[model samples]
Target: MSSDFQNVVPDTEHKGLVGLLPAVARPFAVLARFDRPIGWWLLFWPCAWGIALAGGAIDRWDLLLWLLLGAIAMRSAGCVYNDIVDRDLDRQVERTRSRPLASGAVSLKAAWIWLAILCLIGLIVWLQINGVAKLVALGSLALVAAYPFMKRITWWPQAWLGLVFSWGALVGWLAIVPEFHWAMALLYLGSIFWVIGYDTIYALQDREDDALVGIRSSALRLGDNVHFGVLNFYLMALSSWAAAFWMLRPHWLAIVTLAPISLHLLWQVTTLKSADGDDALAKFRSNRFAGLLMFLACLVLGQAG
Candidate 1:
């Protein structure tokens, strides 16, 4: 791992898609985390949830594609921005020591340039959405800008990340309708809790390293109660989503739409191995499936209901 990142970063997928790129391009890909599809998937699902639950139209499936591209670009830009802000801190953490910036595989100038390029892609996505959705998307920038510093001031940085990530719900809903709806707000709220739960699971991997570096996280805040805490957060998410479904369709059938994802989240918390970093990572990654299930449920509610 000679500052080249050719050997793969610890937390990244081993020899995954990034490896297929050329040598010089590899570092940039890792910088934006192109190797990790999970990041973008998590971001995109919330947008899909907003769209589908807002009454998905067949023609608007194109919007899903645009939103997915937006998710990839924006999530990558956020990762680069976070790495730039956290590069020194990353050096102190074992899991992130080999990150492109931390390892000097990518320079600050290059990283910033890469971030701008990613944002350019996001700008292209902005052209596809309606005016109100664009404004909603803009509102997330402040949250994104401040997110890297959250660990310095609060134990609930994941909550802030929740606010930032779940923002796509607002964008998705607003894209469909010019006005706000209570159901959309609940969907967004549920997504916030969902992010907090999964990201807390993600933070479990960095617990020791984070404490050593004085980085605050929900995992550290909860300590022994991490499992219970995650369970409660998931429950909140499910409850909020159930309420959302009920509001949208006002039927027992709509509530039934959420059963699969609810059971999947249950499996995650119940089977979670809080002591093992690998298990924590697996549980965190499991959110991709959870997001998919949620999307299907929202799709069913919006279209079939």
Candidate 2:
């Protein structure tokens, strides 16, 4: 790999376990993205929001931990699967060209084996949840399986990712309540928009390469108006969340808890440099904090009674 390609593989330089692991294991770690925790954090937050907003997370903290573990494992599995499917495309993209599969650091057979191991871990975590949650979680597999192909088939792959990533909210809620409610649905929808917005930001890093490779992404579709598009998505997300909160608590103050997250998102849009990959990535990674803020809002609102 060229030095330029090496520089662009996200978080490859992070001196985490991927760095400390023996050289043989490093490629697997890279393939699974253990060195880049932002992906799992993004996946875990909606799960936390659902649990916290349903009033069970405070007491059943073990459930939150299980979901977190599931997020890490499943996100890794999803990445491995995506890399396997997109290996050709990955080799063409500047940022992803150095990825384990594309760079031939990990063989396809080994990648498949690693994916199975990650899914096995996810299965253990899934089994710890309630039967309803188990069923709900299982349903996400179809969405997950279809996601890697969305870029080839549609211009709105980020939208499909929103649906897939935000399914965890439903699973988390059903894990505790075992009953469907409008508030949970609204929360899930809100999270879908949230994923769309952040993933759009993430896609900005690849827009040029994506265009050259004929991969469709919201960032490429939006063109120069990407900032405005992100603002609209964030506004929609906040609106859905506000409605969910109002439905759950019906108190004027319950909606106020979202203020911090709303402001944080505002800052992200306002400060975003749409053309700078580093700036785009910084804003994208900052969603981890955004997730924490949203989780805190849910925790407060869920405990309000």
Candidate 3:
């Protein structure tokens, strides 16, 4: 592989398809972050949680599959769009300086084209759902499109991301039930805090660089108190999720189902090394497992008679 293809940040250690693809195709793969399956997994989990909690997963597994596909495609599309919009800022940040668009390995036109292709795939996934779900899914586009600029304007871009990333919860619930419920709303809200918590962990990797570049983030905003902030966010997430579970099943067991994830979040907070970039990345990636724990909690609660 050429040096250009070798420029991916250290955080995404596994090159996967990017490693196997011809050098000419490597930049596009990086742009879509196919090498980083964690992004898609984080995005997919909220969709899965929504489906399971809404009682759709047992009978409508196909819908869960479609939402997963949508998450991968749309997450890729969002990354491409973010790269395009933040190329200048990315060039200034150490971790992002080597991104395809930032490093000039991929041109603006090509990046946009790749984004379009991903969006087209997302559209195909969107078409698989009902009209109301389609509408709910479409509602996320504005949030997605605005996200690249949030770091430029706010200290809490992660909050905006919380809204964007957790949207699948809403879409997943609506895809099956068609009507809104307070439980779904609570699930969505809790997922938002979960995203905020995890993404703050992710932002810790770029804290110094982002500060130097005048970019705002929760990690930077919390400064020395980042770990405390994360703990608070995680606690809020668990509280909200517990409330949602109780609303759904109204049983002690439903709350107990959340114990595993609560412990997992506790482990993440306790083990986190805030100033260590590699540790931050590992903790951020661990949320994939956190998502699974939540899904099981939702599954158990949703399945109860």
Candidate 4:
């Protein structure tokens, strides 16, 4: 990988596919971040978690597939919108300077058209869900629309991202289980902390560039205590998850299901190299698997209870 391509953040997997695209379509593909499946995976996990923990994993397999498609389309749309809004800021940051919009590979008008296309796909997925889930998913639009500007005004934009990205949990829960439960709220809350923790790792890659460009991030905010901050954030995530499990099952054994993910997160914190941008990126990307582990935990508890 060249220095330029490294700017793509989690440039670990399937990146070679982008190189095979034709010049005309390559910019749009990059703009949508289609090469980086990690974003959609992160988005999809919370939705799956919601469905599984809400006791819809088996009969709701169709809904799971539809929601997965929705995550991909909407995550892509959000990236295009963010690029359109933050083209200037993206250019100032070396890590993002090569992005389609910032590099002038894709014009703003074309990006908007592509964003609309992605949203069309998202709309199709949205229509497949129940009215309750539709309304719940729709509520996330305001948070998504405002995300690009968050770094400009707030040091804790990651918290806002938590609210935005973790919203799929709510939608997934409502898809089949519309009844309110404290377990659902606790699951969503724990997911917020999970997002904050992983995104802080992602932010580590841009710390220097962000400082130079006046873009705020939790990684920058925590400074040298980044390790400690993420540790606590993940701890909060596990504790909240444990509490959620208790609410659903009231069994001590349910907490045991969380051990794998808890250990995985501890591994991430224990071995993280804060000064190594690439290491930080690898740690952040590892959450895809962490999300899987969480789904397994949710599956166990959801089915058992």
lDDT per residue (tens digit) for residues 205-252 in model 1: 999999999999999999999989999999999999999999878889
User: How much lDDT does each candidate structure score?
Assistant: 0.91, 0.91, 0.90, 0.91
* Tens-digit lDDT track of model 4 for 123-236: 999999888888888899999999999999999999999999999988998887887789989999999999999999999998999999899999999999999999999999
- Model 2 TM-score (2 dp): 0.97
**Sequence-dependent TM-score of model 4:** 0.96
- Alpha carbon lDDT at 274, candidate 3: 94
- Could you give candidate 2's per-residue lDDT for residues 203-256 as a string of tens digits? 998887888989999998999899999999999999999999999889889989
Q: In TM-score terms, which candidate is top?
A: 3
List the lowest-lDDT window of 10 residues for candidate 2: 1-10
Estimate the lDDT of model 3: 0.90
Off by over 4 Å in 1: 1-4
TM-score, cand. 3: 0.98
Instruction: Candidate 1: count the clashes.
Output: 0
Against the hidden reference, what TM-scores do the models get? 0.97, 0.97, 0.98, 0.96
TM-score result, candidate 1: 0.97
